[model samples]
Target: MKMLRIISYAGLVAVAIMLLVAMCAILEDSVISHRAHRQELTGSTLSSPGLDHFS
Candidate 1:
């Protein structure tokens, strides 16, 4: 019983960490896209900024 409880706790912790990492990655992607949009509007970086530029 004791070992099972420890394993369950570890599993939960691992899942939580994975979720946190995924969330951060998504947020980073959005931030990068937003910045690219801003640069496009300002016309400072590329004249023809397309979808490929963001990715």
Candidate 2:
């Protein structure tokens, strides 16, 4: 009985760790994509004809 209980606790802990790692990876990817999108928007606006008139 004790061995079974230990195994159950270990499995739960392993699952928790895996979930935490997955969440971190997802968050990192989201942040990188957001930064890239912002850069893309800025690049487009900078190339607009109106901005060229200012130069």
Candidate 3:
């Protein structure tokens, strides 16, 4: 019984870690897309970096 409980806890922890990682990945993607959109709106170009720094 003790072994089964430990196994279940371990499985839950693994799932929690997976979900955390997936959330981070999704957040990063949205942030990147947002930055790209902002750059387009502001006409910021690669030749001059940090133009969006003020924004």
Candidate 4:
């Protein structure tokens, strides 16, 4: 019974760590995508004369 309890606790910890890692990966991807989008917008704005009228 004691061994079972220990194993269960270990499994839970492993699952928690995996979930945290997955969340970090998702967040990293989101940040990268956001930066890429911003860069593309910046590039477009720089190349377009009409956007200057809006500013």
Candidate 5:
């Protein structure tokens, strides 16, 4: 019974660590995607000549 308890605790710890790592990976991906989208939008606006006249 003691060994079973130790194993269960270890498993829970491992799962928690895995969840933390997964969350970090998702956050990094979203940040990178947002930056890319912003760059594209900026590039498009800069390339247009009439944008300054409208603003």
Candidate 6:
């Protein structure tokens, strides 16, 4: 029983770490895109808009 309890706790910790990693990745992507947008505004880069209002 003690071993099973320890295993369960370890599993939960692994899941929590995975979730944190995923969240960090998403945040990093957003930050990178925001920086790119700034460059675009300054004419250092160009990218097409992803969507239009008419659709």
How do all models score by TM-score? 0.78, 0.77, 0.80, 0.78, 0.76, 0.75
TM-score, model 6 to reference: 0.75
Writing each residue's lDDT as its tens digit, candidate 3 over 1-55 gives 9999999999999999999999999988987887888768779655245454533
Q: Global lDDT of each model?
A: 0.83, 0.76, 0.81, 0.76, 0.75, 0.77
Model 4, poorest ten-residue lDDT window?
46-55
Candidate 4 TM-score, true structure as reference: 0.78
User: Of the candidates shown, which would achieve the greatest TM-score relative to the real structure?
Assistant: 3
- Candidate order by lDDT, decreasing, is 1, 3, 6, 2, 4, 5
What is the number of backbone collisions in each predicted candidate, taken in the order shown?
0, 0, 0, 0, 0, 0
lDDT of 4 by residue, 10-54 (tens): 999999999999999998898777656766877752434553332
Candidate 5: Cα lDDT at 34: 68
List, residue by residue over 1-55, the lDDT tens digit for candidate 6: 9999999999999999999999999988987878677767778655446632211
Give the runs in model 1 whose Cα sits over 4 Å from its true position: 46-55
- lDDT of candidate model 4 versus the reference: 0.76
lDDT-better candidate, 5 vs 6: 6
Candidate 5 lDDT over residue span 6-54, tens digit each: 9999999999999999999998898777656765878753434543332
1 against 4, candidate with superior lDDT = 1
TM-score between candidate 2 and the true structure: 0.77
**Native-to-model Cα distance after best TM-score fit, residue 18 in candidate 4, in Å:** 0.3
1, model 2: CA deviation in Å? 0.3
Give candidate 2's error at residue 31 in angstroms.
0.2
Give the per-residue Cα lDDT of candidate 1 at 40.
Answer: 76
